[model samples]
Target: MNRGLYEADHEAFRDTAREFVIREVLPHLDRWEEARLIDRGVWVAAGTQGILGLSGPSDFGGADQLSDYRFRNVLLEELAEVHATSLSSGFSLQDDIAIPYVAALGSDEQKARWLPGMCSGELIGAIAMTEPGTGSDLQGITTSARPTGDGWVVNGAKTFITNGIQSDVVIVVVRTDPGGGRDAFSLLVVEEDMPGFSRGRKLEKIGLHAQDTAELFFDDVVVPHENLLGELGAGMHQLATHLPRERLSIAAHAVASTRVVLRETLEYTRTRRAFGRRLADFQNTQFVLAELATRLDVTQAYVDASIHALNAGELTAVDAAKAKWWATDVQNQIVDACLQLHGGYGYMTEYPVARAFQDARVQRIFGGANEIMKHIIARDLVDRPDR
Candidate 1:
């Protein structure tokens, strides 16, 4: 099926992204994975190549491409082609989750101070929402920020933060009005070297070893009033507004990754022999590939439509949730099936299929678990019974 999603400009940008990945990313992946951290130099190189901050303001060196997400989609597709899940995840955090908040909601001073560095990769950004005790329930967060003479004193900890170890600026979600209900939270930007601010050990995971996921701590860390983002007590609203984009970004990666692994597996089956015949000659293999291909195509069409809707500012939270959960589920299933087709060799770390198998498992768990996604969809369905 024809995707018809990318224009000529997007295709041209895709070539540039592909070249950048081959030259800058692929060579360092193994070393980064071994060290459980990516070098900051690669980030700088990406910045120099105009790969970071694509949707940021033009004054801060951003390409201001927010209206068109196809550029970001192209970059993800290229990264998927090479099985660079860790790097993809890291970049997505910066581009999709962190940048949008700063670019869209930060004050002028905040924008001037951080956006340039962020665009240039001089400063890495991370958003701290998930606490040790809280995952999806923002209402349950206990991280508190109390008023002080000139600033707010923050005390709390966040776990499972992407770029947690390397982030130079963190947007911490803190409770501003302790007794207030949904409007109690606020976003405070915590810069590096703020007193009492520290990081826990980089977490070990079953996959995405090169991506830095860790715990962050803030005790008596002073965040000046100037560093606050958006409305003082509107943190929940801000987060809600940005989540659709974040989930759509995840869905984009999920579909792209599934396509990459499927293509590779198809080539492998055509060449690898089984019982004195090509693996592709087996009836079961053909049927499996056919089914996977059909699923990918159908899911891709919906994702593509969602992307267009997002650009048009019409994508809803419910729709984004649908795309995120369904696409990730498909990605995991397809990748697992592809690995099974590889026989014993699939279990080896040297094979991309084995690595993909490890990386795909988290898709269903993160970006609000698939169960949460279904709940959102069901709630919407119930509220609008006419549809």
Candidate 2:
């Protein structure tokens, strides 16, 4: 499918993004993977090139009015073509996860304190929601911020936080009013200079190695009252509202990645031979690719539609969950099969397919696990007593 989702301006942005990746990103991926994190300098470089601020406002040194998701989809697509998933991941966190608080919920002072630094890449940002005892269970979080004289004192920990260590400022999800039921949670911006705030090890993961996922701790750390993001009682609602864009972004990457591997797999199968005959000549290979292509198209349609719905403010959490899970599942299947078609070479580090295989495994796990996503989708279904 041609995926008629972008205007010429988006194409122009794609060209710029492609050049950024070629010039600033791809050359550093291996080193980043080895170091287990992206250097902070690249973030600055990205800001200068205007790749880091898709959703940020023009006043904040960002692009003009690309708060729409379609622009983001194009950014992901261009980056995905080169298998630069880590770069895509970092950009999504900045745009999808962290920036919105400033855009939608920040006080004028808060936005002033953050947005300029963010746009300049001078002050990095992160959101810490998943804790030691809770992963996807948002309401089950244990991090606490109790009342202090002039502020609130936060304590407890978070794990698997993207951009954790590198972040100069972190948006921490904590229980502000314990025993107030699910509405007790609140988001507080914890600066790195805050006392007793610490980071645990940079976690080793199955994929997305370049992402700086780590454990963060707040021990009797005081957060000024002004650091609170959004209404305290509305934390869940805020998260729910923001998650659709995040999941949709992930789905976009899923489809883009699938196409990359699928393209590579097709070329490989056509040239590589078995018993003096091309692997593409095999009925089994043909059948599998056919099925993969169909899956790709169907999944692509859902993703494309979800993008449209998102722009229209009509994409629900359930539909976003469905798109995220299905598209990633399709990406996983296509990449795995594509790898299998390459035989042992697929397992080698030198092969891009091999690296892609490692990278694609996490798609279904993060952004809410596929199982969690299905549960969300199931809950979103309209109940019929007669059925």
Candidate 3:
């Protein structure tokens, strides 16, 4: 399982990322979870460490490692080692989703205004796509922005938004045309203090307590025409183009988490005794661990290859769906089995396995539900025009 996925530079970056997590993440994780929010200070610290804006150009204060995703993968693995998944998810949102979208779609002025601060972690960003009623169906979005004197009046609500509570810049997806169609939607950048832009309560969830998730409301908020991201009527295309990277990032997290839980389980089984023998001595435990290890290795290979494909700009949306669904499925399965092996202790929130079990469930649901992933894959296999 050498994988050979990382180069010397990636390993060097890992050292830096690992040190940061140990210093900034591990000690505060419990307190963050208790408060139901991470302190903004951690975001600044990560920016200073060059971990927040890997995708931005060096001129924007980023590390300029966007094309090589291996560095991001390295950071994820290091975070997974300590079971700091909530923080991992938050950072992933910055590096993988929000930053990339702005970098790809923002005009020069937009980039100059936003990229440097985003790289510095002084500015937090979130993409608001899921409405109160819409999840995967982008066409169903009812949040509409109508043209007005000098700007557009935006009205809508978005729920289940990551970084919603803390985001300084939000790329809000709104319908430019009342009539629903592909050409109807557009992206408007809404700033923090915009009138009628408000955040609802921070949502409580089964897991990811340390990461902020909230409901956002926009009622009659006037967004400048200059704040528009990309072309009008191109929000759908922009979202589709960027979704593969989000899915791949999720796959990477799933694989790294699976490896961590499996490793911990192995160590637990070898040390803990039951019925006058170590748990590892039991035939049942041995078979279970054997199966889990094999599955992890197999899944890791696909994710690794997917990472390479992503770096080469060859990872298709369909392939990303495959990696996302399969890797997360394996991750959840392995974590559940590992938890069961821990007996009652696994049910305790203090145990990382228990926390991982809760955290792993959302992977299959977010970044497009695994069922949606299957639909995408199935459509490719059965509904192609070539067929």
Candidate 4:
């Protein structure tokens, strides 16, 4: 399929991204995974390579490729080609989720203070939304920030935060009004050296080991009013506006990963012989690959459409939800089938297919869970004005 999603510039950018991934990311993956943390140097290298903060304004030392998401997608595809999913996840958090929030909503002063460092990779950012008691329920957030004479005092804890350990600044979702409702939440920027702020243990996960995921704590941490991101009590609205991009990023990665796994599996089926014949010669193998190839192309079409809608500033939450759930589900299905085709070798951790299987499990779980995605789509269906 000639998707025609990327122009000549995107292909040119892909060349740069591919080279960077091979030179900077691939060799260090194993070492970082063993350490359970990615080295900070790679982040800086990515910044220098103009890969970290594409959406940021150029005056702030960013690449300033704000409206074009194809560059980001190209970079993701390159990472997937080598199965560096941990780095892929971390970079997506930076480009798709965290940086966009600041770029979109931060005031000039706030932008000047944070955007330069963030774009230059001197600062890493994390969004602390999930708490011990809350996952995907922003209304249920217990993290509180109260106004004081000087500023606001924040007290809360967040878990399952990507970039938690290495984050130089965190955008924390807090309860600004004691009486909780839609208008009660606000976003506050919590810096790393802020008093009474601490981090918990780096969590061990089933995959994405090189991406630092950990717990964050804030107790009587005073954040100045200047650190406030966006309007007070508008966090819910802000989150809703930005979520489409995050979900779309996940979908994009899912499609790219499935492509890689299927490609590798096809090569494996062609070479490895059984019963005096190649595995690809078997009817069963042919059927599986044919079905998977069709599914991959179909999923890619929708996801690419979603990406275009996003670039045009027209992608809805419902549409993004559809892409996120469907693409990830397909990704998992393809990986599992391809792994099975490898027979016993699929179970071994050494093979890329096995590693991809382990990494693919969390795709459905995160980005607001596949169950929540269906709920979003279903609610839209029933609540439409035409209905």
Candidate 5:
């Protein structure tokens, strides 16, 4: 399968991204994993390379690549090649989830204040949505923001927040109306220095060791009225509007990562001997690879089409959910099988496949669980009942 997904410009961008990963990311990966955090310098280096704010406004030093998601796909592919799952997830949190909210909904003043720093990677961003009690149920969030004379006082806590520890700015989702309706929630941009805003301990995870996932607490943190993102009482709609892109972004990474594991497994089987014969010479090995390859090609086609659809503004939440769940499920399965093929070596942390296996677990969990994705698809099916 030629894929035929990238043009010359995209290929050129791919080269630049690959070079950046090789130089800036590969060397420090081990140290970062040991420390459970990526160095702040890499973000700055990425910003310097014009990679951080691809979809940001031009006035704020962004390339404004939002319309063309293929550039982001290129970056995802390159990161996957190195099995940099932690780094890839961290970047996606910024580029796909957090930045888009600001770019799309922030006021002109908000844009002027934050976009430049975000684009330059001097200011990291995180979106706090999931609470200790709320996962997919945004309506159930208890984080409250009350209007005050000077500003809004925000009080709540968020868990499983990516970049939580390092984020210079956090877009905190808080309930503004206690009545519990669709219009109750609003997003408040909480800066680092805000009083009563504090970060909990960095969470320990089975994978994504270098990525900072943490719990955030807002205790009477006063966010200025000007810091509200999007219209008040419209948080649910805003989150709904942005979710398709976020899911698609996850799907892109899932497929790219699956391809990396498959490629590496192919090479490993070609040389590694089993029972005095090459692993590739076995019929079972050949059959397994053939099956995996077919699935990869078919899934790649659908994902590519979805990318094009997303760029054209036609990607629906249903479709994005399909891509996200399917690709991530396939990625986990493929990586597990690849690890099986590697036998004992795959279990060793020294091997990329082992780390990939661990990292792939969360794909089905986050960006809304795969189960949630199925619920969305099922709901759509019932609603249409025609197609």
Candidate 6:
């Protein structure tokens, strides 16, 4: 089916992104995977290519025309084609998750100071939200930033933080006013050079080998009061305001990753033979593949519609939840079936399918769990007396 979701400008941007990925990222994927983290130099290279910060202001050395996120969607589609989910995730974290906070909340001085560095890849940004005991429960974080005369004193720890090991500046989510309800939490910038800010062991994950995820600890890490990301006691609102973008980014990845596995499976099935007959000759295989293709087409449509809605600023959290959960669900199912089609080779790490299968498992769990997504959707659809 023809997907007319992107304009000519977006198409041009995709071409640029593809060139950047193929030249800089693809060649380095294997080495990075073996190392378990992408090299810091690549970030600088991406900045030089003008691909790192697509959504920052021109004055800040970022792409000035980043209003529409469709460019990023297309970039994910291209990267996903090569079965590089880790790379896709890293880039998405930079362009989608981190840049938004800088653009939306950072003050003029902050923007001038950070945006240029962020856009140019001189600074890698990360947001620390999930702690050891809390996942999806934002208010349950035990990390705290206590007020002081000069600034604020932050202390505690965070786990499962993406880009933790390499992030130049981490936006640490901490409780500022203990009894301030859901509003007590606030995000403060904790720089790498801070006195007591430390990154713990880089946790091994089932997939995303090239993407760094780690635990962070803070002990009397003082953040200048100006480093507070948004208004004090507005952490929930701050997170709520941009979650739709985060979810949409996940949905984009889900759809793109599905297409990648499907494409690879189709090619493999056509070439591999059983009893002198190509695997594609089997009726059952064809039927299963037909189902996958149909589902991909259907979900891709929904995802594209969601992207459009995101651009128009009308995408709701409920709709994003629907896209995030459903597309990832379909993405996982398709990959699992595709892996089954590969028989023994599917389980081997040598094949991209195996890695994708493992990596896709985490999608339903993060960016808000699939269950949480359902809760959000349910709230909007079901009538409640409490409301």
Off by over 4 Å in 6: 384-387
lDDT of 6: 0.88
- On residues 304-379, what C-alpha lDDT tens digit does candidate 2 reach at each position? 9998898888998989999999998889888999899999998886778888888899889888999999999776
lDDT at 60, model 5:
80
Local distance difference test, candidate 3: 0.92
lDDT of 1 by residue, 1-387 (tens): 678999999999998899999999999889988999999998889889988888788888787888899999999999998888998998888888788899999888888999888888888999999999999888998999999988899999999999999999999999999999999999999998899999998999999889999999999998898989999999999999999999999999999999989999999999999799999999999999999999999999999999999999999999999999999999999999999999898899899999999999988988899999999999989889698
TM-score of each: 0.99, 0.96, 0.98, 0.99, 0.99, 0.97
TM-score attained by model 2: 0.96
Better of 2 and 4 by lDDT: 4
Clashing pairs in 6: none
Worst 10 residues of 3 by lDDT: 1-10
Query: What overall lDDT, based on C-alpha atoms, would model 4 receive against the true structure?
Result: 0.93
Alpha-carbon lDDT, every model: 0.92, 0.86, 0.92, 0.93, 0.92, 0.88
Off by over 4 Å in 4: none
Which residue pairs collide in model 5, if any? none
Alpha-carbon deviation at 149 in model 1, angstroms: 1.5
The window of 10 residues in a row where model 2 has the poorest summed lDDT is 378-387
lDDT of 5 by residue, 7-87 (tens): 999999988999999999999999999999999999999999987888887988888988889999999999999888898
Worst 10 residues of 6 by lDDT: 378-387
